[model samples]
Target: MSTIEAHDLAAGYGRVQILHDVSLRAAAGEVTCVFGPNGCGKSTLLKAMVGAIRPWSGTVTLDGEDITSLASHETLRRGVALMPQNGGIFPELTVIENLRMGGYILKSRKDLNERIEELLDEFPRLRERRGVNAGSLSGGEQMMVAIARALLLRPQFLLFDEPSAGLSPKLVGDVLKRAAALAERGVGVVMIEQNIREAMQVADRMYVLAAGRNRFEGTPADISDDRELMHLYLGIGKREEGTT
Candidate 1:
């Protein structure tokens, strides 16, 4: 599977640049985690890559095809999906309602129903709560709905912005577990997550972004062996004795 590549991408809200020549590649069938502090433009990088924010310069290419100018809807049509930090689901919509809306791009009712049924089968909790309002579900369940909704689009590359932002510890782990499962299914997953330890646990490749620019990209082993590096980038100190 081909990867999504962002080359020298510089983008932000009007007249304010958040990303500074950022470049990274997320290959299909792997999970690439972007770690950084707040105000580091992690979400902006996601926005730029998905064409939600047009880049001041550079290109977002999927398998070598340029998509920097595509609108958000058009980008999704290209089989790239993004689940943002917030507003990914309709609070008032039921589980089935949100899942059905996910396949709205396809007009065939039969196909839509089939897809929805397939997803429902895969996510049994959603199936059980098919009638419950989304706002009524637990935080992890709501995130499950978001994942199910994104999968309905049949995307090859999925980008998640801060999947574990405000959840409890258990819920945060649950969310990352779901992301890992997506990678196992051969979806190219690029996620910006603040839960550094959990992110490292499931990542195939780790990219450390500081101040909106790419700092370090390496395997998990690289991170594990470099205590000082973790301290410098993530403010994490060495584990004390008997703290394993």
Candidate 2:
């Protein structure tokens, strides 16, 4: 199976360490959700995995090959793409134009156009607003644009950073369902999320990060049943006695 594994990762910006001994594994056809409080190095972990920032130690392996040092573009070429937080889209650009930028690495216009059409079919809503400026769309629509753009390259693994941020509860579910749908289509998905309840609904496996380290890694059921874990990391209040 195709997998992206980060083992014993320790990385951060200049003179400040944000992650320490963090590890995670995401496999093709599964959704692995990572959760934690703010500044727990959730985004930093994704950055390190995709080479947005180099790890001070440890390795990021793609199907067993060490790709820790590869540049972001190089990793993208190797079928791993990171959709950064906040739906990275050009406010002034139309939906189709933003999508075109996603395929900038493709050498042939025919291939690019074909890929764009394929994604449009997956996200039919995007087709309806292809000519409209992305910033003018609703939060959910903008997320669809960002996701479609990421899929233009047909990556084997897609990493999402807080994909549900700045959206209504309904849109959070919508965006997370899209992430789960991508996994169903055989793409490895690693997502950083704040919506614990919703994320558990779609995640095949879960990893909880705290203080820049691995705190918990288990199936959704495992997390829900653990009172301490639910209360401490997932922000769920513990069930009281006789509350069956």
Number of the top-ranking candidate, with TM-score as the measure: 2
Question: Candidate 2 on 1-244: residue-level lDDT in tens?
Answer: 9999999999988999999999999999999999998999999999999999999999999999999999999999999999999979898999999999999889999999999999899889999999999999988899889989999999999999999999899889888888888899999999999989899999999999999999999999998888887888776866552485
Candidate 1 lDDT over residue span 1-244, tens digit each: 7889999999888688889999999999899999888888889989888988799999999999999999988989999988888538898999999998888887799999999999999999999999999988888788889889989988999999887777899888888888898899899999998888888899999988888898888888897767766878887765542374
lDDT of 1 at 161: 88
- Report the number of clashing residue pairs per model: 0, 0
Give the CA lDDT, 0 to 100, for residue 74 in model 2. Answer: 93
What's the lDDT for candidate 2?
0.93
- Rate residue 240 of model 1 by lDDT: 45
Alpha-carbon runs more than 4 Å astray in model 1: 238-244
